[model samples]
Target: MSVTDEILTPRGPARVDTDVPAGAPVALLVLGHGAGGGVDAPDLLALRDAAVAAGLVVVRVTQPYRVAGRRAPAPAGHLDEAWSVVLGVLRDRHTGLPLVVGGRSSGARVACRTATTVGAAGVVALAFPLHPPGRPERSRAAELGTGLPTLVVNGDRDPFGVPESGPDVRVVTRPGERHDLRGDPSGTAAVVRDWLRDRGWTPA
Candidate 1:
C-alpha cells in the first residue's frame, strides 16, 4: 500500500509518498523527482514497485516548491535543505534500516550532492543530467565523479548527455529513451536490482 506525509523544511513543507513492501523491509530508498515532474514518473513508479518486491521501502519525495504547487524547482541549495529534512524523517522512522538515496534528473543531481549529508549507503542517479541541454562546457560530471559508490542509469539519447564511466561510478545506458525515461523501465529496473545485489543490499 501507499501513504503520504508532510514535513517542514527550511524552504517549506515537503511531501513524501511512501510505498512499503508487503513483507519485512531491511532498507529504505528515498527518491526525489525531476524538476518538472512528480512521484508519478513511470521510472519512479517502476522503481518503487521493483524495490518493494526486493524487500525495500521506497519513498518518493516532492520538494517544498512542488508541494506549494510551483512548476519551477527551487535552487540546488534549497533542494538540498528540503531533501535533508525529508531524509531525516526516514532515518528516524526506519532507524537502522540502511538508506539509499537517489532521484531522476534534477533529483538525481541532488541525491549525488547530498549523499554524504544523508549518510546514504550508495546513490542511484536515474537519467542524471551530465550537463545542461546544449552547454557541454558547463559539465556536472564532477558531481558524479566522487569516490562514493554511485550508479548512473542514463538514457543514451538523453539531451543532457551520457556521462563517461568512472572507477567508482558505474554507468548504465538506456536505449531509445531521453531524459524522461518514463515509457518503460524494465531494463532500468534490472540494472538497479543487480547493482543492489552486487553491493549486498539485496540477498544474493
Candidate 2:
C-alpha cells in the first residue's frame, strides 16, 4: 500500500491523507490528532506511516478547529458535529469494509464517543486519556462502551494507568513511553492489526 494526499469535504474543508492498496479489499482506519496539534503531529504521522506500511488504508483528518487556525479546543457540541461530518466521509468512501476510528489524546476521545453512535466495526484507542495527569478521578472512560472489541494501547506509565485492565477490552502497554506509543510503532500496529483480523476485518 502507498499513501496519497487528498482532501475530503466534510464540514468546511477536511484534509485527508490516505494510504491503502489500490482497489484491494481493505479496512479503513481513521487517524486523528491530539488537542494541541493538527493531523501532522509527529506521533500521529508516525502511526499513520506505520499503519500504511502494514498494508492498511489509513486516513488522517484535520479537525475543524485546526483547520480554522485556532489553538483552543472546539466546544463539545461543535466537536461532535464535526466528527459526524468526518465519519460520514469515511463511511461513504469505504463502504462495506470494516471501519476503525481512533486518535491520539483528545482525538481518541472524540472517536471513541463517536463509535457507539456511528456503528464502526471496532474501535482503536491509541493513548486513550483516562483523565488529566493528576486528576484520575475525573475519568472520561465511560464513553467507551463494551461489546465492541476495543484496542486500548497506552504507555506503561501513561498517567491514567490505562493498562490496569478492563473486562472485555484488549489493552497493550508500551514500556517507558509517554501518552504516545513512541518506541515500538510496528509492535503497536501489530496488536491492532491482529485484533481487527480476528474480527474478520479486510486485510490491509
Candidate 3:
C-alpha cells in the first residue's frame, strides 16, 4: 500500500510518499530527488517498486523547496536539516527497522551528508555527481566517505564525473546511461536490489 504524508521541517513542510510491502518490511529505504527533478523521476520510481517488491518499505521524499514549487534546491545545510527531521519522524513511526537513505544527484549528496547524523544503516547513491560537468578538480568524492556502506550507481557517460569506489563505497556503472539513468531505470533498480540482497537487507 502507498500513503502520502506531510512533514514539518526547519526550512518548511516536506512531503513523503511511503510504499509498504504486503508482507512485513525487512528495511526502510528513503529516497530523495535530484535538484532539477521531483519524486517521480524514473529511477526513483523504479527503486521504489523494486524495494517494495523486495519486502522493504520505500519512502520518496519531496524536499520543502520542491513542495513549495521551486525548481532550485535549498542550501545544503538547510536540506540536511530538513532531511534529518523527516528521518526522525519516520524512525518514530517504524521503530527497529533498519534505515537506508539515498537519492539521485543532489539528493544523493544530501543523503551522504546526513547519513551518519540520521543513523542510516546504509546509503544508495544513484547518479552521484562526483563533480560538476567538466570540472574534475572540484571533486565531491568526500561526500561518499560517510563511513557507512554506500552504493553509488552512475552512468558511464555522465557529464558529471563518476565517483570511484572507496573503503565503504561501491561504485556501479550503467553502460550507455547518462546522469539521469533514464535509459534503463529497471536495470539500475536491479543493481540496487542485488545490493540490498547481498547486504541481507532483502530476501535473497
Candidate 4:
C-alpha cells in the first residue's frame, strides 16, 4: 500500500507518496517529479511498482510549488532546500538502509545536485535534460555522475539531447520513447536492478 505525507519545507508544503516491499527492504529510493509534473507521472508510478516488488521502499515526492497548485517550478535553490528537508525527515525513519536518489527531468537535476550532500548510494535519472533545447552551452553533464554509481534512462528522440555515459554513469535509451518515456517503466526498472547488482546490492 502507498501512503501520502505532507512535509513542511522552507519553500512550502511538499507531498510524498511511499510504497514498501512486502519483505524487508534492502534499500530506499526517493524519487522526485519534473518541473511541470506531479508524483503521479506514468514513469514515476511504474518505477514505484517495480521497485516495491523487488523489495525496496519507494517514495515519490511532489515539490512545494506543485503541492501549492503552481505550475511553475521553484528556484533551484528552493527546490534543493525543500528536498534536503524531506530527506532529513525520512533519514531517521529508514536508518541503516542505503538510499538511492532519483527523479525525472528537472527533478533528476535536483537529485544530482543534492546526492553528494546526502551520501546517496546511487542515482536514477529518467529522461534527464542534459541541456535546454537549442542550447548546448548550458551543459549539466557534470552533475550526471557526482562520484556515485548512476543510471540514466532517456528517450532516443528526446530533444534534451542524448546524455553521455561515463565510468560511473550508465545510459539506457528507449528506441520509441521521447522525453516523456510514455509507457511502462519496466525496462528502466530492470536497468536499475542491474546497476544495483553491479554495485553488489541485492534485494532482501
Candidate 5:
C-alpha cells in the first residue's frame, strides 16, 4: 500500500508518495521527479516497485513547482532548498535506515548537489542531463562529485548525453532509449536493484 503526504517547504507545498515493504526495510530511498515531470514517471515508478520488492522503503517526491501546476522549473537554489526541507522530514520518519537519494534529469542534479548536505549514503541519477542539449561546454558533471557511491542510468540515445563512470560512480546505458527512458523501465529498475544489492542495501 502507498501513503501520500503533502509537505510544506520554503517555496510551496511538496507532495510525496511513500511505499514501505512488508518486512523491515534495508534502507530508505527518496526520489524526485524531473523538472517538467511528476512522481509517476515511468522510470521512477518502476524503480519504486523494484525497490519496495527488494525490501527498501521508497518515497517519490513531487517538487513544489510541479505541485503548484507549473511546467517551468524553479531556480536551482530554490529547488535545492525545498528538496532539503522535504528530506529532513522524511529522515525523521524513517530514522536509522540508510538514506539513498536520486531522481531523473533536473531532479537527478538536485539529488547529486544535496546528497552530502542531506547525509545520503548513495545517489541514483537516471537520465542525468550532462548538459543542456547541444551545449556540451556547459557541463554539470561537477555536481556528481558527492564522494558517495552513485549510480547513473541513461539511455544511449539521450540527447542530454551520458555521464562517464567515476571511481565511486557507476553509469549504465540502455540502448535504443532516450531522455524519457520509457523504452525499458524494468531494465532500468533491474540495474538499480542490482546496484542496491551490491551495496548491501537490499537482499541479493
Candidate 6:
C-alpha cells in the first residue's frame, strides 16, 4: 500500500500523489479535482481508492489554482500548463505501462483535450460537466474524441443529463448520482474497472 508523492513545481505548485504496485499490469491513471474541490474531496477519493483496488496505479493531483486555495478557477493557460506538467510526470514515472488521464469536471475537460493529442491509452471521466447545467447551447461534449476507450460515469439526474446521441460512448448513469457521482461508488468502481480492462489494463 505504499504511495509516492511528487510535487510538480513548474508554472505553479501542485502535488501529484499516487498509489501503485511495483510490478503488475500497470496503468497510470491521473485525476484532477473539480473546480470546487481539491484532490481530497470524498468523491475523488472514493474513485481513486476504487482504481487502486482494481490494481491500476492511481494519481490524484490539485490544479495550481486549487493548490493556491482559490475558489474560482485559474486562467485557462495556467490550468493547461498544470495538466501538461503532471501528465509529463506520469509519462516519466510510469514508463512501460499504459497511461489513462482524466479528471472530474474541468480537469476531465483538460484530460479529454490532452488524450486526443497525447495518445493516452484510455480516459475515465467522472461527472463530466457537459454544458454547465442548463446551458446546453454551450456544449462541451465535443471535447470528447473518437478511437480512444472512454468511460463516462455520470449521474442520471445530472444537470446536462445523458447525451444519448453518440456512438462509442460508454455511459454509466447512477440513478441518484449528481454531477459528483455521489452515493455511487460501487457503480463507479465497476464501470472504471471494466473500462480499464477494455483498454488492456487488467489486474495482474
Candidate 5 C-alpha lDDT tens digits along 55-121: 9999999999999999999999999999999999999999999999999999999999999999999
Compose the digit string of candidate 1's lDDT tens values, residues 70-149: 99989999999999988988899988888999999999999999988888989999999998989999899998865678
| Model 1 vs. true fold: TM | 0.97
Model 3 clashing residue pairs (backbone): none
lDDT of each: 0.89, 0.72, 0.95, 0.87, 0.95, 0.75
lDDT of prediction 4: 0.87
Per-residue CA lDDT of candidate 2, range 1-204, in tens? 335444444445556777775456467788778787777755666666656655568888777777778888877666666876778867888897777888878888788778767777677788888888888788777866645777788888888657345665677877787876677766676676677767666453
Model 5 spans with C-alpha error above 4 angstroms:
none
User: What TM-score does candidate 4 get on C-alpha atoms?
Assistant: 0.95
**Model 4 Cα RMSD, Å?**
1.3
Query: What alpha-carbon RMSD in Å does predicted model 3 have with respect to the real structure?
Result: 0.7
Q: Backbone clashes per model, in order? A: 0, 0, 0, 0, 0, 0
Distance from true position, residue 111, model 4, in Å? 0.3
Q: Which lDDT value does model 5 have at 16?
A: 92
Worst 10 residues of 1 by lDDT: 182-191
